[model samples]
Target: MAKRKFKKQIYRYECTMTGEAFKTTREAPNPNDLVSVKAYYELNPDEDDRPEEIKKQLQTEE
Candidate 1:
């Protein structure tokens, strides 16, 4: 099926000065706004749910 878009979704952003990356569903700050994000992208959770990785981690910890 074709991908779908949601009104509010996770967005990944990087710090212009620190290059630190973070994700949030709230509105992302502009590239040069106070938070100083250098770049960002929509992080659709469905595209990378990684169920296998989660299952493996859970098994290892058990």
Candidate 2:
């Protein structure tokens, strides 16, 4: 049997108010890496806009 490969995805998020950025990697990000990447999301609800922006940027690139 052939081995299946798990691809690592890079996700980036920026704060809408401060322009601060966060980044991380995951094998398969759920809700999105921006939402699940770290514990910061739980602490800062306002920074959750990155997922949709990242999705849009990815779509545009492809």
Candidate 3:
């Protein structure tokens, strides 16, 4: 069996200076044109996401 891939099916954008939403997909601004951009996604929900505690022995070496 082969794994599958997913892509973003939808996107939206607004003007940075005017605060108006774009009316059409073709009119949306490039991400670089915006003052700031934010992307959202999920990662490894079943596993611990934080770094493991450093052992005292290794900490002293650094």
lDDT, each prediction: 0.56, 0.57, 0.44
Q: Which ten residues in a row have the lowest lDDT in candidate 1?
A: 34-43
Better of 2 and 3 by TM-score: 2
1-62, model 1: which lDDT tens digit per residue?
A: 99887677777876665577777777654754424322222234345445688757755995
Better of 1 and 3 by TM-score: 1
lDDT of 2 by residue, 1-62 (tens): 99999877886666443455766674333433333333464467587667778757755995
Per-residue error (Å), model 2, residue 45:
14
What ranges in model 1 sit over 4 Å off? 1-8, 34-62
Model 2 CA deviation exceeding 4 Å by range = 24-62
TM-score of decoy 2: 0.32
Please give the TM-score that candidate 3 achieves against the real structure. 0.26
- Tens-digit per-residue lDDT, 1-62, candidate 3: 99888654455666565465544334344654653211111133344333446334444775
Model 2 scores worst on lDDT over the 10 consecutive residues at 28-37
Error of 3 at 23 (Å): 5.9
Global lDDT for candidate 3? 0.44
Q: TM-score of every model?
A: 0.36, 0.32, 0.26
Candidate with top lDDT is 2
| Model 3 residue 11 distance off true place after TM-score fit, in angstroms | 0.7
